[model samples]
Target: MAVRLPILLFRMGLGPAFGKRLLLLHHTGRATGLDRRVVLEVVAYEPNAGSWIVASGFGTRSDWYRNLRVEPKTVVQFGNRHHAVTARFLAADDGADIMARYGRRHPRTARRLCAFMKLPSDGSEASFRDAGRAIPFVRLDEARPRLP
Candidate 1:
């Protein structure tokens, strides 16, 4: 019931309003072989590279993270834009830097996110680095358009 609501809204085209802050991930379940969808917060976006950095707040055990490991090819919807992407796991140091940068940009939200994830963050780069090491980060690189 909870998940259905956002999926409905995203499908209705309200996604763009959230911009790069939120995205809908469409991935295949590794175990069930069924399609699955989830909404995730975008920690950062590299416009030059057409990539987004996202973290597995629920840790490495998150179904989506696990699923992506099995099948890296996926699609993400941000606002009204849909992009085919390949998910790549980020190194612990890189994830830490991403988190630190995100905290600087959105302090309140970052604090809430850390709290929700049961991660401790003192709003310092080092503290965020510690938390980053405990979780998993992935870079979703947008696939280039295919030429026919």
Candidate 2:
């Protein structure tokens, strides 16, 4: 976890500059009532459709995802802007398809996905394919922006 701290801080700070693609997600612990925010790489957005898609590269092991399992509603922040969003956890089948598409568009992310999922990076398509299945994909429906 300590090794990941610097990377996490870097992502949290420069996320927006990377693109409109990175978003900061806030989730509240159902039991502890603690507010937690995580930086996620946003791979796709459908403005016309009014939705955005994100992937949990950390798979089901991520704390934020666990919090969401208990509390589906969350807050999202992107490029200095913030919104109250509802999280819809896509079914495993749908998540797999979305992750495949995401990997196709962002090959670099696919590599990171493999590492995050604890898959062997033998540089094989099969490894990547398996890694994709382990990650979790989510869609966010954001409401109007508001100050956090």
Candidate 3:
């Protein structure tokens, strides 16, 4: 229910408005080889590197995260643009840095996200870092030209 609505909106061509903040990830089932899709929030974007950072809010056990671990190649749709990208899991230390930086910009949302992820955090850098280390963060790097 929470994800179905956004998937519908993106399908109906309303994805561009959300742009880099949210993306639709297209991946394949590790065992089934069937296509799967999910809408995920963008934790951060690096313009120079053409990369988007995202986390498995449900931890590495999340289906999508597990699938990506089996096959790192995937596609991402942001707004009206689609890109072939590769997923790379970040190290715990790197995730901590990213979370700390994110907390500084969106403190409230960060707190809420931590709660939603069942991660304990008191808004301190250390807490956020610990929470980050507990979850899995992936960096999606553009692998090819934009899709039509």
The lDDT leader among the candidates is: 3
> Pick by TM-score: which candidate is best?
3
What Cα-based lDDT does every candidate model obtain? 0.86, 0.71, 0.89
User: Over the stretch 19-118, how does candidate 2's per-residue lDDT look in tens digits?
Assistant: 7767778899777999877777776787665567887766777888889988888787766566678888877667656656666777776777677677
Against the hidden reference, what TM-scores do the models get? 0.90, 0.74, 0.92
- Residue 124 C-alpha lDDT in model 1: 79
Better of 2 and 3 by TM-score: 3
Better candidate number, 1 or 2, judged by TM-score:
1
lDDT of 1 by residue, 28-107 (tens): 99989998999998888877778888889888889999999999999999788899999999998887788788878887
How would you encode candidate 3's per-residue C-alpha lDDT over 9-82 as one tens digit per residue?
88899998786679999989998999999999999988667789998988988899999999999888888778
1 or 3, greater by TM-score: 3
* Model 2: CA > 4 A from native: 1-15, 120-130, 144-148
Clashes of each: 2, 0, 2
